[model samples]
Target: MADSYMDFTSPNTQFTYTLSDNPFFQKDAQNVINTLSINQLNTLGNVSLLDIFLSKDNVVEPHIHQNATELVYCITGGAVVSLINPYTKELLNFTIAPGQVANVPQGWWHYEVANQDNTHLLAIFDAPVPEVIFGSDILRLTPANVLAHSYCLDEAKVKDTLAPITDTVIIGPPASCSKQHPNGMPMQQMMNHGGMNMAQMAPGSYQQAIQNQTYHYPYRPISGESESYNAPLDHPFHPIPFLYRRWD
Candidate 1:
């Protein structure tokens, strides 16, 4: 999938990724990644190959992939992958450091964030068919009302906090990968101050939420404009999830 804009023969092997940018993901981590994909391995199957990733911390956020099961291997350092079981409000969690793998069933909500250094991990899907939908993109790129409604946050607050979804803690901004935003601020402070309140990835949430009414928003868009025709109410158009590929 190489275009004139993205040639790999002289690829920036420093970051082995090319083509397949997304409507919601970022692609500036070329320095930290070495991603290569094999188009199709077997007999016209969905077997796509993913190269190893030097996982970064904020890359962690809750997300779901619709059509595939994923297995992740931690090559170094450590990571924490968790999920809230919909049936029980308790979180099913795991601490994955070096030389270990975590298995996540498909269609479940999950997310992974790296530790202090350049933690490495390899992701292998059951069918080499996997789609990554970053949380920042989903929250920032989707219609404003949809973003707020999906997470049950006040619409005003969503706007005040999200400037076309600035570099989120999920993935560091352009300058560097540190505990701070390239925009200038500490990440823990950002999340603690509410960068990502609904951020939880316990891949194990295919079960329905318990009837507590304490968790999860009602996910309802005020009856109007079908959520498709409504424009960004007079704002500079920010191309969303321009970070990576999205199947949504």
Candidate 2:
């Protein structure tokens, strides 16, 4: 009988990994991700993973995976997974605890936030190499005039806000940020200035909010079309389009 482990001619076909062997990104010594992809595991063909570790209120910055879908499983602590569905153009959010999971479709913009200390989540992808576009790059690289004209934003403010993002920040709220939140406000306040009142809500209420909250916006065209043909006049797209809550 031939020994099952005796094939060594191709020394590069690795079958195991120490995920922490490489650091994907880290911020303020509080949040970090150890990414494993085709670059690290030559034998990997259809899948990869990110070992995410985040402290309380820490966030994995908004990003898009152009090549694959992501399945996130929580191993410890709690977190909120948020994504924007481009098709429906609504922002969706989910809160997950240990033993729960969330899925983000390919090419959708998404982010994750840790709700408790020592949060650990595994982000699995369907492609061997999941190509990513971080929001930091988009905010920093685009010409200010283009953004100002398209979004009707102030060019100077756009440039000033994004000037500090010189590097790709996978974990965000850079350590140098000085906009302090007085008192113990909910972490969502840090994400948006008009914070949701989550500090006094029960966990169940929070989950309900995740399940029911939907962002509604008026439809506007980007091209020469008058209105979207398949959409209704009042609310053209689906209201609650993209979020999937796996468990409680």
Candidate 3:
């Protein structure tokens, strides 16, 4: 019988799809990623997923999925999913272990850092293909002078530092880098590290900052600002849109 309701492709003819066969992207030896989407399974074109494997301290660099909301499930070990809430203007960090999940709204800047070795995660997306903007790309693509002027940063320093980021860093802080913080954490934390449940913040403090447009964390307050705060709000490490040219 010809079914008018759907295409006549036979599901039985299509062999079982394996995640291992789909290679989306990867980093060094410590990080591996597998992707699944409409490209592989036509039946589930509206949804997509990423299988990520990382060693201790490895990071899925800060980026934004312009097209889809991501739901990340921790399959093994531990990790910290960090993102900013646009509505509250509050930085949120969730510690995720096996059986835990974290969600990142579409177009939000976010990143994941593995807290332990053999960390595995599955990131499911609402779209078939997720368009992303990596923080490293934004930093490298934008002219140093533009960034220096916009954020009042020194031009020379910006150029010298970002010169190394020539490509989209899928996973970062390579295992070879020996840099460490005084507390024994890797240098990854140097880029706006946030903690879960900021207890030191007084009640209504974040709300007030959101109202006044005076939330200052990593950067000094703009001139004429008396109230200053030093919270996890300093996440310039995340990707932000920068239009270089207009498409006609």
Candidate 4:
């Protein structure tokens, strides 16, 4: 009856039991079951393991997982995950089917919009506390004055968006959930975040198709003191070359 067992005592405590002891772990968990306590899961870095049998009408709103990468595996049903990278103005959307996987990068805003009917889904993450940097948790958990002073946003604005600050739970009342960016961070404004994407990249910008010359410089000693000049790869020094090019 128990494929695996975990005791979810709270947000940071747990006891673990495994079924097959398989390192890769098991997929298609609907036929079997396993559970882990919250404390045991705190050691889990950026992830939520879901065994969901979605009904005819199920919905997960637009949200971002803070400080973690999202890897969702569709077990019995497929889903449409939406993502927008504002800085680059690039968008990568998906409608993955059963047995397929979707990867969402860390700290970038994203959401998964499921199908119209029932489906089974499994979500994996790269963190133990999945919403450590999530918008809702940030808006709901921390003290407004502390966050406002740190972020440099107006305390009144922070208060309006993340009202009634308290520790946010993964599964909690919908009323407490806050917006992804209360100021409404639309895709067009993504450029402000400095996020990278294809649209923002100029064509052939990094292509090695053209040849370019690089210069290395030799530094003169300060009378008797030796010094080393360490330069970065993207740019180099060439003051000496210019000084002597017209000397002869």
TM-score of each: 0.54, 0.70, 0.71, 0.40
Off by over 4 Å in 4: 1-38, 41-48, 132-248
Regions of model 1 farther than 4 Å from truth: 1-46, 146-153, 166-170, 173-230, 233-248
Q: How high a TM-score does candidate 2 get? A: 0.70
Tens-place lDDT digits, model 2, residues 1-248: 22243344687667788888877666645577788876787666677888899987777878887778999999999888899889898888888999999999998999998888899999999876666766755664456666777899887766655554554556655554322344566565545433334344343343343233222223322233543344331132322122111100
Residues 1-248 of candidate 3 have per-residue lDDT tens digits of: 22233353766333347987886555555588888776676556467788899887778878888778999999998888989888999878888999999999998989998888899999999886666666756776567777887999998877655555554556765333333544554544544466322223344342343233311112122233433334222234422333121000
lDDT for 125 in candidate 3 is 90
The lowest-lDDT stretch of 10 consecutive residues in candidate 3 is: 213-222
Model 4 Cα lDDT, one tens digit per residue, 198-225: 2233343312111121122232322333
Best-to-worst ranking by lDDT: 2, 3, 1, 4
lDDT of 4: 0.42
- Give model 1's clash tally: 13
C-alpha lDDT values of all predictions = 0.47, 0.66, 0.65, 0.42
lDDT of 1: 0.47
- Residue 102 of model 1 has an lDDT of 83
Candidate 1, 85-171: lDDT as tens digits: 566665556668888988777766676656546676666665534555455555555556656667897877666555434333333
lDDT of 4 at 34: 28
